[model samples]
Target chain A: MTTATIIQSLASGLLMGLLYGLVAVGLALIFGLMDVTNFAHGEFLMLAMYMTFFLFAFFAIDPLLAAPLVGAAMFVFGAVAYLLVVRFAMRAKANIGMVQIFTTFGLAILMRGLAQYFFTPDYRSINVSWLGGKTISLGGVFLPVPQLVGALVSLAAFGALYFFIKKTDFGRALEATREDAGAVALVGIDKNKVFALGWGLGGALVGLAGAVMAMFFYIYPDVGASFALIAYVTVALGGFGSVFGAFAGGIIVGLVEASTALILPPSLKSVGIYAVYLLVVFIRPRGLFGSI
Target chain B: MDDAHSKRRLRDLIVAAVLTCIAALVPLFVKDVYVQNIMVLTLMYAALSQAWNILGGYCGQISLGHALYFGLGAYTTVLLFTKFGVLPWFGMLGGGLISAVIAMALGYPTFRLRGHYFVIATIVIAEIGFLLFHNWDWAGAALGIDIPVRGDSWAKFQFTRSKLPYYYFALVFCCVAWLVTWWLENSKWGYWWRAVKDNPEAAESLGVVVFNSKMGAAAVSAFLTAIGGAFYAMFVSYIDPESVMTFQFSLLMALPAVLGGIGTLWGPVLGAVILIPLTELTRSFIGGSGRGVDLILYGTVIVVISLARPEGLIGLFAKRRKEVAR
Candidate 1:
């Protein structure tokens, strides 16, 4: 392959990694704090993408502008879901972990069905004047403007999240709860409210990533399933509950995927990804950066 | 104690044998191809689900990638038959061996993780299989490999005339799967599996070779599942990645165990008895129309079952009731 093609693949990998990092961060946060698997985690992204697609198609709102609304909407959705489903479900005996996993699985199917019935099984995308004929030449490499913008947005989001989690009281409270729920409750913080906010924040981040990813990827009911699988892999490889590990894992996966596509057939690229998932599973069961 | 238990078991066996005899005579009374096809499919599913139960239910591994083993067996036997003019009965051994090996490869690494990790690993491995099989040119890519019909021969695993042979083949496969499950439940290894499943660390501390026990369960489970796959290929006389290796196919195996009582011996049998008939009826009604109506219904039901009654339908009767002393 030519130098430009190699660079393009590298860029694509990095861009995809950024997107993966966004979703992984959300998944990690929720999993870290709540210890719930959230099999429907990817479906929230699906909902966001669908919303972004329709908003751009019908209301002429740009995806960047639509991201906030989707994030906010998902925040509310997450809180409500936590209250209605996660709370009561967690209240049951601890032996019912499979119940939680399968419940989210069922919710995922229900949401997919709703999307399929209402949206129909057609490929959807946003049509924007700016997205048309947009290309940027950077550092002797060609990068799509949408991808660059998405990476920047993802970086900014991660930066803000880091601050919120580390610098602020609510973030600290959330972390406290993650470390010790009973202790956090003992310290005058409303444990329920903290969990609700954490869930909301995690949902919002994933939703925003979905909206941004929609600009590049096509929309479908099963679109999230594939990506969700990848994000989970990234999370585990990075260290199950570590935020920084997510970044490391995403980039590693993205690079591995790009390099494999270079060496192997495109159809067999998923095998490489799964190979890494299996390798990490065997060698470092807790993940490269995970404590557990 | 042994005498009483054996007597009761003999009575249950007689009842089960009578039921099997009635089921075996079903083809004699039914001349319709449609009913015969349904019976064949039901038996195949029943067999597949039982195989699935060995790992997912009894061992508590919850493998969502059981289709990998199933497809491996299907492809192996089909390839052997098509390439070498080998008889399927002999070819099925190769298929079973290959499938068992693949299961071992997949299960060895992932079974180390607790709970959900194992589930995710199985899913990812299945997806890997789907991608490879879907894209490989040698396996006919997405179009799939086909075994040529060299006239009707029982040895060739091709019946030119009717579906009766296939029906009997599937019935025998189901019987074999049930026998395997029965053997597993009564064995010391079965007790070890239960101990490890309930608490791996405890089992390990108690000197149980946890990994070996799990691998053993996985191998047996996969071996039986591969046999089902072998039967499925011959019955349909076709094999393809899209048709057979889908994640939904794996989930279909799990559904039986999930709905019948996950770890119970008769779970898959009851699950297949209840759901397979309904799934067949729905497939007939909606599959031809291309609306995905059956999948939607099936997925919805699975979700509901998992959320509300995870112990499944059998849970209602099987759970021990606390005595009220009022």
Candidate 2:
């Protein structure tokens, strides 16, 4: 292969990988703190995409400009979801796995159904004057402007999140709760509030990723279904609850996906990804960075 | 006490006899082709879900990848019949054995993972299966395979113009699956499985070979589910990876057992009876314009039941009976 071609593929893969990492961090955080997988996590991403679309369609605002608004809306949605569905499932004395699984699975179907009802299952995309149909030439390779911006936004979001978790007292409390909820409670921290905040932050992160993606990707009711499995694989490969691990895992998965496409048939590219996932699961269940 | 026990046994026998007779006779009375079709579908789901219950409910290992086995069984039988002219009867048995072996192979490595990790593994494995089949030309790839239409022949397991034979075939399979579950519920394996499910570490401490017991359950479950898959291949006379190996198919197989009562012997049957008809009626009444209403209803039901009554409908009945006795 030519060096230029290889550079181009790697550049695109790196950009895509950043967004994938953003998609998985929310799932990892929620799982680490709440101990629920949130099967409907992808649907939340779908919601954000739709939210971005509506904001653009109704007010003629650019999706990038409205990303924070969508993120804030999703934060409230996530907190409320935790209070209503997840808390009750956690409280159940028997069959905790069954209850938790179906609750989120049900929510996923519910959200998809509601989206279809409202949006009619048609694929939607945002077309901004600045973002659409533009590319930047980097050395000898070309990079799509929308994708580049999305990747930068994801990196910024990741950096901000890392700073918050590492530097802030609330972030420390969140981490403590994840490590040992009973111990955190003994130290006068409210475990419930910490969990709710985790959900909110997780939701906001995914929502921002969704808005960024909406600038370039197709938007639909079932759009989340495609990304949901990939995000789950990222979370597991990253070691369940570790945000940095999820980010690293995402890049690894993206690289594997893009590089394999050069060798395997398009249909079999996913097979390669799944094979990697199975290997990681069998060989290292704790993931690359997970402690337990 | 002896007299009461005998009387209860006699009553159970009578109930079983009556149900069997009704199952045999109902298709004859239902003249509508649509109703018979629904019955066939309901019975197929009943068998498939019962097979799932063996692993997911009794053993407490939730596999969202059961479609892998189901598709394996279907493809095995279809390929053998189309290539070598093997009778579907023997092909069905071959399919089941293949599925059982595959399940055992997957189960050994996966059963080590607990809870959600196990669940994720199942999904990934199933996706792998889908990808492989979607690209494999011998299995017909994405275009799928169609069994050549043959006139009504018991040897080929193809029926022309009569839904009755297919209905009876499905009913028999469903009954067999139910009987196996009933037998397992009373057997030593059943006790071992319950122990493992309730607390694996404790069960191991008490001399149970936890891995072996789980593998045994997985084999039996895969075997029965494969038979249902083979039957489905003949019933539909068409097979595709998208239809048979998708995550949606896996979830649908598990839904009935969850809805009726996961661990109960007759939960799958009860759940199939309720769900299949509900799906059909919604499809007819709401039609195409109301595409997602049925799914919305199903999601609502599942969420409400999981939240308010994790034990399901049968569990509610059992609870009432205990209260009355007290």
Candidate 3:
């Protein structure tokens, strides 16, 4: 293989990795704060993608401009979801983990059903978006314009997220709540509020990813199913609960996926990622940036 | 055994016997092929769920990637028979053994990880298998293996003329699964499993009992699940990665146990009884539109049931029994 070819794939892999990180960070944040794995997270992405598609179709808003609007809408959706469904799941006295898994899973199925009922199971995409069908040359390597923009937006979001979590009062509150849910009540902090906000933040992050993905990817009911597995693998790979871990995990996953694509058939590329996940977990158990 | 436990066991056995007798007579009264199909499905699912309950319910290992084992069973039977002309009776046993070994092999790395990590690992492993099978040209790749119908004989385990044989086989499979669970419930391994499920750390302090019990459960759970897969392959007469080894099959097996009762012997059967027919009816009636109304109903039922009764529907029965005793 030529070095340029390797670098070309790696370059695109880096951009895709950033987006993957953004897709995964919300899930990581949710798990980090509360030990719940939202199995419906992929469905959330699907909804956001559809939201982008509709916004563009109806109002002609470019995906780039519609990103924040989609994120804000998803924030409300996420918070309400937590309040309506996940809150009850958390209160379960028995089989707490399974309850969470299945409930979110059911929610995923419901969302898919609803999406299919509404969207008619057709694959839709933003054909005329501002960044759609464009490419840029970076250091003699080509990358899609949408993906480049997505990588930049993702980096900015991560920076803002870091600042928000480390510097902001709400972030510290989120941290405190996760550290000790019982103790936070002693300090007059409402546990539910933090969790709700956390869910919102997580949702918004993935919402941003969905919008970016919609520019280049198809919008459909089951679109989230495949990416959902990858997101879970990313979150778990990055050590389950660490937000930074998810970021790191996404890059690793993207590069692994890209490299695998180079070596194996396109269909077998995901096998490389799955294989790597098994290998990593077998050795490290917690993941790369996960707390030991 | 304690009088109450033994008495409860005896009552369970009697109830099972009566139920089996009733179920055996079902084929006589129900002649419609569609209803017969549903019954076969219900029994097969009950057996599959019961097997899942052993590891997932009793041992408390929530594996969402059981499709790998199911696929393995289906593939093993189909491959051995189609390629080598081996009888399915032998293929079923071979599939069971392969699944049991694979379960242990997988459990080795995965069992040490706790909660979601373990769950995701199982999912990833199964997905990898699915991908491989999809690309495996020798095994018919994505198109999958079509078992050529030979003569209608018990040896081949294929009967085109009658659904009766499949129905009976499924019924016996269901009974054996129930009986196995019942027998294991009182065994030493059962005690260890319950203990390990309740508190793995404390159980682990007893020197490998936790690990050992989990391994045991996974093997048995996997073996029976594989047997179900083999039956399904023969019954359907077609095997594909999408049909057998996808993530959906794993979820299907776990659902009956989860809804009816995860750890209980009767949970899978009861859950399958109510669920399989509802699923079939919904799919046939409303799902014909391909609009996914059935999915909406299914998702709603699962969420409501899991949220409302985390211990499963079996708890309601147990609660009523307790009240009556009082």
Taking the tens digit of each residue's C-alpha lDDT, what string does model 3 give over A31-75?
A: 988999999999999999999999999999999999999999999
List, residue by residue over B1-326, the lDDT tens digit for candidate 1: 39976785666567567868988998999999987888787788878888888887777888888888888888888888887767888768888888888788777778887655667788888888888889877877899987788888778878969999898888888888877777777688888889988988899999999999999989998888888788788877888998778887897888777777777766777778778877888778964554556657765776667656767767665454222322
Which scores higher on TM-score, 1 or 3? 3
Clashing pairs in 3: none
- DockQ for model 3 equals 0.82
DockQ of 2: 0.67
Assign candidate 3 its CAPRI class.
Answer: high
lDDT of each: 0.80, 0.87, 0.93
lDDT of 2: 0.87
Interface RMSD, in order shown: 2.6, 1.3, 0.8
Q: Tell me how each candidate scores on DockQ against the true complex.
A: 0.46, 0.67, 0.82
Q: Positional deviation of A133 in candidate 1, in angstroms?
A: 4.3
Residue-level lDDT of model 2, residues A97-192, one tens digit each, is: 788888899889888888888787898888763687799898978999888898898899889999999899999998888889999999899988
* Per-residue accuracy of model 2 over B1-326 as CA lDDT, tens digit each: 37875675556557656877898899878899989989999999999999999999998889899999999989998999998888898889999999999999999888888766788899999999988999999889999999998778888889978888899899889888877887787688989999999999999999999999999999999999899889999999999998788898799889888878888777788888988887777667763676577667777877887888777667877788789989
Better of 1 and 3 by DockQ: 3
